[model samples]
Target: MVRKHLLAIGGALGLGLVSAGLAQTIEGLDLGAIQSRAVEQARDAEAFLSAVSDRGKDARDEARQTVDESLAAVKAIDPTKLPKVGEAGAIDLDEMVSGAQGSLDNPRSAPLFIAFASLSMPEDSLKQMIADVHKAGGVVVFRGLPGNNGRMFAAAMRRVVSQDASGNVAIDPRLFRAFDIKAVPTYVAVSTGFTPCDDFACKSRVPPFDRVTGNVTVQYALESLAQAKGPGAPVAGAALANLVRHD
Candidate 1:
């Protein structure tokens, strides 16, 4: 049975009616009792607000802890010990290129990653960017939970990608700092694999990488990086070829 508290709504109305009745019946009806009740209601409202604030803070704390655990798990992986690109029984490059969902959880890293924020791009643009990144076999990284709330972040991500495309999404601010990404929609391609370090202060000694900041298509970014023959040229070239083949 759904219990409804009479004291919550009807009780307040009844009190108001009683006060009105008393005021009509008594020649000198002082409103001290009504005033006291009003003050109590005000205090109850304040207490309710405080409780809500505390719950929100607890939710944020939990979300932050979850992100931290994910970061630590990813960092503990040793990329150097994994098989190389061409080694047998190792990760299949073709498979990764075709379906890179859950790249955040996968031990094998993608050739490129897209730094993104739901608030930074228009709704249509953000959806298109996520689809494009998925097609290009690249991961899309968000800095953290939106409003530091997990539910809000999940809702925002769901609005961007469909269920199938959700796997390519990840949440980690370290990648943003690692690539020196000052703005959203930044692209980074790394020639060597990624093995995130635990220490935030220490600069990760990673292989050559190419970075571009703008609102450009993943294909365009890859083509530009490959054409420049920069540190990420090799990886970008491969990713571009795979994207073309899949398209």
Candidate 2:
């Protein structure tokens, strides 16, 4: 059984405690949501302090409240640091390779396999997954965590597996916080929709095809996505890709 830890990330001023070294945990916290709410709290607290005079009792009371809220906000998880998702913000996923960019018979725009990886996650394992995903003509998106030394992390990854034909993108760190990711090596299969965007701007939105398939190996991730898009079957991550013809 995977042991999920209770995590508390402190100090947005400096997120030094989180990284590839510590165990990855995303169990019960909607960290991205928490951070957003906290920022709003901190802003409100700051406004209160700026207007209150320090010479009166209101000043002391306001100061105490401000300090408390500030501390909480600074310690809250910053969503800006996670990967960027279509729902959270603007991401031109069309730039990446897709069924439209590739072949039509290959299944709907193909699945977007987003990987939340860190240095702590085994390299050989990740490399194999990358290779398998490419073989299946899937997109491999890498999401780096806070504790990663950018240069060293990429160098390490390159040393293991370098060729990703479908193409890969380093997800916006803030985007990682938006999803309910619980651990490293977690894979999300976006196999049903064309434009990953489901907001008001997108007219061709389908039921959310984004499925977090727990912690799975690379081969399993690809296989699961293919199964998810089958003609009639509707498994969590096992459905067939819902491809459409380009006009």
* Tens-digit lDDT track of model 1 for 1-247: 0011111111111101000112111111112222323443333333323333444765434434443332233223333333232211111111111111122223243235454554558877788776777777777766543433422333344456553455566554445556766787877888788755332222345667888778887788889988999988877787788778878
Roughly what TM-score does model 2 have, to 2 decimal places? 0.39
Tens digits of lDDT, candidate 2, 1-247: 0001001111111111111111122321133333334454454334334444444775546464534543453334333454332222222121211111112112233234455555566667766655554444344444332232322332343344433331443333222444545577766654344423311111233334444345576555545655656421242233223111110
TM-score for each candidate, following the candidate numbering: 0.54, 0.39
lDDT, candidates in the order shown: 0.47, 0.36
Q: Highest TM-score, which number?
A: 1
How much is the lDDT of residue 40 in candidate 1? 39
Instruction: Please list all clashing residue pairs in model 1, or write none if there are none.
Output: 102-167
**Residue 146: error of model 1 in Å?**
1.8
